[model samples]
Target: MLNIRCPYCEEDRPEIEFRNAGEAHIARPDEPDRVDDRQWADFLYTRDNPKGWHAERWRHVHGCGRFFNAVRHSVDDRILLTYKAGEPKPDIERMLREREA
Candidate 1:
């Protein structure tokens, strides 16, 4: 089973304890009423399906019950890192470079 690290709990737990919450870093419209139907639809439905490293939101349901962000490799389904919810997305390119060093 996949192991996911919870940023809040500071421990690695089984994937069964967590729930994938979908793509992270999605920004809601500043004024929902002002947004057109098409814009609203795009915001609600559109998401990146990248083949490589992707940032996603995950909830530690069975553990801390806190939501966190994680960078996972889509091809291998390996979680590279986890961070708190409001933290800025990490630079994946830099991280890969550092890993190679």
Candidate 2:
């Protein structure tokens, strides 16, 4: 029902067209016991739950078979930006310009 941006096609695609993969840029600790409870908790539970400009990792399952980042707004349900898997995530305007170039 929601419209999600496909990082590959660089277009505002529907959510149904894509799949909801887990959090992005999550690196596990090298040593399990060395990591404290707070750190573990952060890895396990803490996520960027924001009202505006929330950065999340997404997979273009149906399109490019690539993973990228998306910046979206939760309150208004607007997708602000999208970027390639390795490309830097920027504001919507900057991302659009990067995609154009």
Candidate 3:
């Protein structure tokens, strides 16, 4: 059972209370009507499905009902950290470096 902390609620809840929304920080095009078909399709369908560390969006569906970001390891199914929506993505490389010091 994965214990996930909701950034908004500030409570560690069971994984069943949350839902993985998808990748985080995908910016929408400035002009939707002007976007080419290929570009538009890429934006909608493409994702960086990394096998290792990944930054993703999650919603505390049963709790706060707010969306947040989480850094997780795909292979291990471990969530490293969770942050509020609209917050800048964490600097993972820098964090790892700091952890080693």
Off by over 4 Å in 1: none
TM-score rank, highest first?
Answer: 1, 3, 2
lDDT of 2 by residue, 1-101 (tens): 77777756868777866776655567678897998999999988888766655667788787777788777666876666667777755656676578699
Error of 3 at 12 (Å): 0.9
Poorly placed runs, candidate 2 (over 4 Å) = 1-3, 30-33, 91-101
Per-residue lDDT of 1-101 in model 3, one digit per residue for the tens? 89999999998999999999999999889999999999999899999999988999999999889999999999998887899999999998787789799
Q: Give the per-residue lDDT digits (tens) of candidate 1, residues 1-101.
A: 89998999999999999999999999999999999999999999999999999999999998899999999999999888999999999999999999999
TM-score of model 2 vs. true structure: 0.66
As for candidate 3, its clashing pairs are none
Q: Which of the two, 2 or 3, has more lDDT?
A: 3
For lDDT, the strongest prediction is 1
**How close to the true structure is residue 101 of candidate 2, measured as C-alpha lDDT?**
100
The ten-residue window of minimal lDDT in model 3 covers 91-100
